[model samples]
Target chain A: MATIMMRVRQIAGIALYLGLANAQEASWRSPVNVLSRKGLVADQISTIWWFLFSTASLVFLVVITLLLIALFKKGQAVPKGPVQENSSVRPILYLGTGLTIIVLLITAVYTFISMRTLAAPSQKPALTFEIVGKQWWWDVRYEGESISANELHIPSGEPVHFSLHSDNVIHSFWLPDLAGKRDLIPGHPNSLWLQADEPGTYRGSCAEFCGVQHGKMNFTVIAEPRAAFETWLEHARAEANAAVSEEARVGQAIFMQQGCAGCHSIRGTAAQGEIGPELTHLSSRLTLAAANIPNTTGHLAAWIVDSQSIKPGNRMPSQKLSGEDLQFLLSYLMELN
Target chain B: MFRGALIIAGLAVILHIGVILISLERVKAKPPLAMPDTTGRVVSQEASSLLKHYGCGGCHYIPGIAGANGKVGPGLEQFANRAYIAGHLPNTPENLVHWLMNPQRLEPGTAMPTMNLTSTEAKLIAGFLYGYDNDAR
Candidate 1:
């Protein structure tokens, strides 16, 4: 009885472990990896995809049927003796050619109609955003406001206009759940419009191959109600509040003393380096390093010590600081919100 | 056919050379100004390593430093003759040291990062920059 109980307990533990593992895997794939239709543009694109897929599948089935008939039908086989033309051969050829033309013309017309619909510009946009692609990151700026990076906040049920530009090389802005990918070309300005139907966080990526760290260049689009979006924007536009705690104050000093301010800018303080992302109101963000890691104190400290370890070839250099200084800087950055 | 190909190649070479000569003339129109050692101070040779270790070369262009041709920040060539540091602060030895050590305090939104350098290191770097001769370029 004792051995049986022990065996049952071991099986229960294994079952629990497997369940937890499955949950973790599901969370990783949920909302982030799926091709979603959470926005107006995405909905339209999804419809077009369905239409194209069904039509292609029909064409594939028809071709396969013809091939099978040609292979298996004894009557259609090559002549072993004298060749003779069948009465049905000419009509079959004519019918097949006419059907192919009709199908192709229909597919072309549908494709043109979808293209025109997607390309039509919005009459009036509720907000305008300008996103400039850099070597391996994004510089996102709202019209006539302070610049932010990696994350964009927009209001649900409202059309938003985006003007894309590239500072160095070509990079494509793709928010698969919100809109189509648009190229950001140097010396040329391209625009797109998108609207979210509900409140949710959608992931975006740099679709074009830009540089060494292109795969890691990710961003988030947070959709909320208009009132909430306005509130967030107002707060983002203002300078960060002063450090309140003694530890935070020490971290603030260390931030300036250690030259952290040279590459990252925290608006209320003197750390105004433009080569990297803006860190003002950083605590409010869910992730760091362009969503490569979660925004926890441990992750932030690790990133400061060796950014290359987290995301190799990123512009932020690895820093060497004492444990005390590192703790202080982490505390200071956490309090920026 | 061979003769025609040779003439075409010659015209291509001439066109390439003509483009190069035109660009070179354009580059010569504005010559870089000379920077003199106004303070007559000597910088330690160790300052170069300090600059590299601190990642100063990751943003600014400093002469005689390997991998220091970063275009993010302005070049340090003829830095002493410039009337201002960061386009605002007066060019003085003391000001340069202060700016190097704590740039954010001096200018809030300036792109120059505040490197946490010791007073001695800041002085050494400032001396090297101020004493840079344009002839080296």
Candidate 2:
């Protein structure tokens, strides 16, 4: 008993320490995940959804109970045909059908009303990011500002908003653990938002039938300590002015000579092509080739050589560079961040 | 009852096949050349240069046009082969002309704005685009 008590005390102390560390001082504080939304209207809708779910469960339980009772009254040897109920079956039938219809009608009304109320006057967005989803990729641009995909590098604790749209075909922006799904239509922009609760990698995907390579569409909401992100920003700024070493300079020259900049932008150079992915912070990203391939030197080179092998139908073409040229380009691309 | 069940099962199987067909992304029929579709229209380098002047791909999808894969509009790969122009308009030159003139006349909620093309320019573009095909430039 004494040993168990001592162990309990120690565990309690550790839990208390961890709880203090996890206090809401440096974490996201929106209640959308807490209980739907911090908004009054959203909270009400969420409450209604929970209520309907519970009510459906209750009705299911009652029906199941009656079904079990009816089944057990006779075993497997029971009558093979539908049994006629009591002579007063009309009332029960009418009531059962009426209740079912009523439940469905209420649910439909509640769903429509709540969805409609999402755009109410009180539901003004907190912040917004223009997320233009493409074939197996997403081009997120901050409102009236530029947000390079090389670093999802969002400011911590603030509501980083998202305005969703598609580039190639229909795609959906869904960060299930953080926010909801929004459809990206061509020539049409839909809006959504999320405040990452903590500094971690929140994965999202394209939830619509985009094309042959729709399954590979994946993005991450990477939140970090504000100061750390600030350091990253400074590093990104310096990358534009990133001095080219002799080897990298030769590689940069190769990039230019090989016409890489014609289809890709390198920020502070003449290669202002917008057809390909931005190599501004190409090395900083966790994945490459629209998150289809892992970001390793060999993989990057392989992707540059034959991207179609990995992501079958992406827009970038397979370049047949010699081994030396491929080595040189890889060196240059790795220095982008 | 057994016959009824068989018929229902067969119908379900047919429906399943139809769904599988719909879900399968149909292979886009590539043209033999970069010329337009059903019509044998071909765009010139000068006329291609006119693409930039007009910014045709700004709100439309046109493969190989300069700054073509922009996010503002749908990408053009099988545009001419599409059965409908907008959401519901028929795929015909005159119908397309009517749509290009005023889209609201066709689909009330279309996001594509009327480009107001001249009869000559429209016919030329229609002919050239109708012939676009499978070969990569």
Candidate 3:
């Protein structure tokens, strides 16, 4: 018996260690993990979650213990005509009800306090970003100047303001690790203020069912130091670089001649169209097609040839171009950085 | 009572099948737009296919085309009936072909883009637009 107990203890230890290791490695990076918080707003919410969880767990333990005791402790069966409560069970019932009420009142008060804390930021926001939720993508702008798509950059350890707008339909912006969901209604703007305590990348997505590609509509929030973020913004505000390589020059010509210039825009060039996301710094973005795939040369080539296959029902049409022209186009796009 | 319930169930099955057949018939019916008459006018028929191939339906609501319900641009249901192209140029066959070729040159800063349409393709599209109007009348 002693040996069996020792074996069980060793197995339990290994299970606990594996569980903790998995939580630390994977759960912190998951956007929906409310417990692994990196922002001030998320921290407050986590506190509330922990409070409610602990209280509810204690109540569960007490109830389960009583249930087990009642099951084991055999007693004379009560007559079954009219339900009669025994005097012994009366005390247990009163104790259970009283404990339940106290837990409920505490949780209610805690939730109210957290809600008030989450209502506003502690300090004035140092930066403001205007985000327009387009169909299957996000258009991010800083002070109405530098424009980017599907990526938002901000300085860590400071409150950052966001003004959300929808170009077509209603979409809900949700980055669970940084803040709660905020709806972006067309013609009706909504504002949110969030602050990250540390420098990290938080993934966000459209929570509302806007259209067919709602699940593919994802964005990234990159938090960095103040100086680095400012430097990055300055670069993002500039226009595209002039075509340097011979292939890139051919690619630029193809971009203008083909229908690619019809719906997309690249600043510093004459390819201005408001129908699709701007590709002024196409090479700099971390992902493509609203974070559905990584931004790689091969992936980009596949996307340019047939974006419909990558994301069905999207706005970008499949291009009909020769292999050489496509290579030239890819070269020019890579030089935009 | 069981017999009555069985009779009602039988009637419900028949009604469901009837509704499905009617809906299938409606789905098979042709759209309410005049197609380009394919009588020796091969360019117009090819132009209609080109419009779908170029994904024009992704932006404009062109009639007689399946899945062309886009709301970004104005509907092209009665293209030949419009007095002016893009609200300025007089609607003519030649003018329409030019607009289709170089939309940016005619109206600078216009949302209409200069696609990679050849002169022949532009003329074909114009012919199809006029042919559709004549067939409709």
* Candidate whose lDDT is highest: 3
Tell me what fraction of the real C-alpha contacts between chains A and B each candidate also makes. 0.00, 0.00, 0.00
Candidates 1 and 2 compared: the better one by lDDT is 1
Q: Write candidate 3's Cα lDDT for B47-92 as tens digits.
A: 5545644455544666544445544457776677889988899998
Residue A263 displacement (Å), model 1? 1.1
- The digit string of per-residue lDDT tens for model 3 on A1-337 reads 3444544554454344434433322222233566667888888878778887888888899899999998999778778699865686788888889988888888888878888888889798978899889998998887775378888678999999999998799999988888888999998999999998898777888999999999899988889999999988888888888999997999999999998888888989999987788999998877778976556554566578767766789999877776567777877888888
Task: Kindly report the docking quality category of candidate 2.
Answer: incorrect
List the candidate 3 regions with Cα displacement exceeding 4 Å: A1-32, A80-88, B1-137
Residue A302 in model 1: lDDT? 56
lDDT of each: 0.72, 0.60, 0.74
> Per-residue lDDT for A202-315 in model 1, tens only?
778899998899988888788999999999998888898999999799999999888888888888778888877888888887666775555555456556776765567888
- Candidate 2 per-residue lDDT over residues A1-337, each given as its tens digit: 3444544554454344333433321121111252444334334555776878898998899778877886787544437689855565477578778988888898889878877765443434454667777776877565543446523665556556677776668899876555557799988888765555467655567889988878878776667777887776555544354537665777788888887878877777776787665667777776665544445553565567666655668887777676556656766777777
Residue A266 Cα positional deviation in candidate 3, in Å, after optimal superposition: 1.2
